[model samples]
Target: MNGTVTELTVPTPEQVARAPKVVLHDHLDGGLRPATILELAREVGHDLPADTAESLARWFAESADSGSLERYLETFDHTVAVMQSAPALTRVAREFVEDLVADGVVYAEVRYAPEQHVEAGLSLDDVVAAVQQGFDEAVAAAETPIVVRQLLTAMRHQARSREIAELAVAWRDRGVAGFDIAGAEAGFPPTRHLDAFEYLQRENSHFTIHAGEAFGLPSIWQALQWCGADRLGHGVRIVDDIEVAEDGTVTLGRLAQYVRDRRVPLELCPASNVQTGAATSIAEHPIGLLTRLRFRVTVNTDNRLMSNTSMTKEMTALVEAFGYTLDDLRWFTINAMKSAFLPFDERLAIIDEVIKPGYAALAAEGV
Candidate 1:
């Protein structure tokens, strides 16, 4: 009750809601529409606590927002349980992009663990193909075209890093843009997947590791020093390594300085952070400080359905909490575009010709 006024002078709600944006850390499994989940559950006879989309959406948000990683992850059990077929996977992937497009995201890279979908007796290749087809169809069908790519993920607790990395490289030209590993952070460090990281690097491929999340700098250090990640998926805990003094002076630890100097992008999901206990709340999060320090911080929705969030919603929360401006939103979008796994020329075109122009048009019209 600070009179709904913010200390940071953030942007208005309308500005954030309408800003053109880019997303790079979304999970396809985590973004299945709640209504879609109900339909698929009906097909497979998967019993759910809520038969309807509204109740299910509430369940997901409540379960995830409980501030426990284990409970947050349990919600995915229901989502993954329903997404066991090719058509189901394809439909979810397509709708994921359609939702992004509707949220003013011009470019996005959606990711999911192929292993999670194979319980339907399909091979990893089949799962990848189905999801890629969905992305293709969605982009083609959009009135405002969305540039979509896939990031194949390996479950961290499992031992399929090398295999999943190969899957990513195998589908490299087939719409798969990069490799990633998700799940537990402490025991399943990227060092466990060094061979995968080495292969991707030697193949001149890219990957993002879900580090510095539930775990801390050790997780991030392994992803960077041991595995050589191009970007960090939810590397929110890096803030733990940085210190700001009473006199407004900043001191960066060795790890933070290294990451900042290398321009390693941080795919920050503010709402999801609060949901998963990465941040206590949006206002106390280090996103504002990181942005001020010029870290390559990119906003994202780690999971739209699970977190009950969208890119616009994430930006809106940041605006309310930190008082970001339209320029700040624009800068976050550009940061995501720059940090994408796309090639330099293609990434540049997306930003220069597509993202900037789109934003400029909005600004020109005073939208």
Candidate 2:
């Protein structure tokens, strides 16, 4: 044996939990705590599937684990039902930020559809204001200094994309970071919201499209080529364009090469993807090859409640599946920071001042 000793440096669960994380595609309505949901539902007389917090949490996870995107999305009905009033919206948003702080997320963009919250007679602007109030309160109270922003998502099945886009731009200077188009991706393509995407583009705003998770490459193509999405939310289907030969040589189709060449960020949620039938498991997820090919992959928790995930949990899962070290985790964090919808200088400051230092400290700990 050689005199040199090699020590593997895998990050422990604690180290992963402590490492600074940045998430670009978290949903506000999709992340309420089980206990909070129970309380809110009780106040609103909204009947839930389960009574206890433990059972409610289990119900959400089990319901979303169905191998169908439509079935998975059906789980959000209960969450959205309880968030109609202004106070409920504010409370949920505040708790959302607190949860992110606990999960070691230094920066996050939480998204929700203002249109959905208007069922309780709240105007679109009222919903935005209420959510922002909660965010401001939580940020002020957070001891760890977290930056949270909003991305107004226009549901694809609805025709209010333009109105929501306007609302997002109107609040952009306040706390809204960007805009997005979400919901089922099968019948309703991103092209259906071309006008809203074009408007945001003209306003010089950033946006991501919920593209490749449920559908395939066409969904991704329309989101990028037709709608001009700045980032792809769960662009897992880009793998459909990639082929591996019997000898293990990989080939990328034109669209896949274009995505990589342009450095388009893929907001990948591993657990959520498996739940929605996008990938079979974490080990078989396309993130492994996408990261290997340098496709600007960024980890995200699409729905913390539904997928039963957080930034820390997602990182730990990736580490177990792919043997990702601290360096890999740092790379993912920095990639997300770079791709964030925040101002370039602000993103740089977090990268230079916060993320880099945080990872360096972890490295020093020999984790």
Candidate 3:
């Protein structure tokens, strides 16, 4: 309440790890295990820069911290290059869910472009089906189990936005929960996909767009007013519209008021934001400011390998930087689950049974 408290008490990793979590913005291609990438690259003769899995993992972490967006995105080329086949997509998706389950995620929505993975002669249907099969396998093998949903993504700089929008609708109720457009948000405005957004609207489909991350308020404005996005993928840049007076009073711009008042979810990724130069550092990040303002803010790992983060790591960073408590962590998880594209009944069941009781256990322990 006092800006960031002078006597900030952060949660321990154990406390954060034990709590149930939810992720709504993780990318399927961005989250492959380092070891699997090494093996897969070798099998496909992709000739990675690093010889060992450990080094390769370190390479991604280091490369992503460059504070340059164009360089940050180039790293995904290698991961996507190897994920052109059904087996590759399936294996990666399975491992993605397995990793989320281990990180105490009770629910996750893993997103990727169907068009990006079809280079191996697979149809759009084949790519989605393969990823879904992998998710089914991993869900079955989870300890307490986690629900996984796919968000079909259309690369914003590409011309296939409308086509991918249709693919997403076709996969609705089967595995894909919604649609998203990711990539270079500055010049490639969400309005560029007006046709796709309109089609998704006609189908009554839910969608989030990559906006207000590397860009600013105009990007967020177009996503909400022009494209009619249901959620924002990394809406961290919406902080551009929040002004704080010297006396500690705060004011929201018209767009910010609409986002907060209308309860449009902002999928905020603090650590990833820093790596991408969206925020200078986690403490200076607007996440605490936004959450304190009662904006529907949630934590996420935009890239597990690149950002070197899990959902637990994201929470730990929040605790260390913002002095977030177990209560704060619970609020973030519920925010993510609530903003998820699942049916109302399914989302409510997860909140009641898994999330509520999980946080309750910590509360009983004097957390």
Candidate 4:
């Protein structure tokens, strides 16, 4: 409300939900529908603390709010338990895409650790193929078209980084978009998987590393300098390198300056950061400053089910906290599209053809 009349008008939740969004850090196993989880759990004879879908959903959201990244991740055990088979994995993946499409996500990269899903005797290749098939089927069935790709993840504390990296490379051309390392970050560091990252680099493949969420600047430093991650998953800790004075003067340490100057995309999930204790709240999130400084800041949903969020919810929260207009929302969307692991032409086409037109129509509506 501080700008011109036209610029002062904030977008409504409905309008924000209609904006085309691009997601880069969503988790495949972390986004299952509550009903699907109950159904799968019953079919597989898995024991869940909550019997009903409503209670189970509430349990996940409450347990993940423990303000500890390790504790928050513990809730995934239930989601992953039912995803061991080809059909469960396929259904979860397809339903995930359908949910994203409904939330106005035009492009998304879903990441999950395939090593965790082979417990039911399914091979790693079978897991990846099933997920790809689900994505393909969902895209075909969506009322509105969406582009969905996969980022195969390796648990950082585990020794299968090299093997998972090889799997990602093998399936890169077949719906697998990139590779990533996810898990607890404090004790298990990215440097431990140097060989895997080196292999990916040698193969000319793209990968992201989870860093700077529960850990500090040192974690981000290692992920970028040591492993050569194409993006930083939840790089919220980069805010540690920035110092702001009471008089509004700002200064950045060497690492933060490098991140901004190089335009390294920060896949910041604001609500998830608060739930995991990386950020205190949305208003105090580093994305506000990073966006003002033109640091290629992008919003994301790290774990939708755990955080009880979607692209619409994330965007609506940001709009309420920062008073972001359609233009500001568009900036974040375009940043995600550009940082996508897809080819330049495909990304450009989505940005120009899909995202821009969607926002333009919303702006014309003046909501």
Per-residue lDDT tens digits for candidate 1, residues 1-367, read 1222222334556656666789999988889888999999999999887878899999988888876777887898998998889999889888888888889888899988999988979999999999988999999999986789999999989999899999999999989999999988877888988999999999999999999989999999999999999999999999988999999999999999998999999999998888777788889888988999989999999989888889888988887887675667778888899999898999998888887776565555543
Local distance difference test values of all predictions, in order: 0.87, 0.92, 0.88, 0.92
Assess candidate 4 and give its TM-score to the true structure: 0.97
Candidate 4 residue lDDT tens string, 122-169: 999999999999999999999998999999999998999999999999
* Model 2 lDDT tens row, 113-172: 999998889999999999999999999999998999999999999999999999999999
**Clashing pairs counted in every model:** 3, 0, 0, 0
Off by over 4 Å in 2: 1-8, 68-71
Q: Model 3 segments beyond 4 Å from truth?
A: 1-10
Best-to-worst TM-score order: 4, 2, 3, 1
Extract clashing residue pairs from model 2: none
Query: Each model's TM-score, in the order given?
Result: 0.95, 0.97, 0.96, 0.97
Displacement of residue 80 (Cα, Å) in model 3 is 0.7
Residue pairs whose backbone atoms clash in candidate 3: none
Quote the positional error of residue 301 for candidate 3 in Å. Answer: 0.7
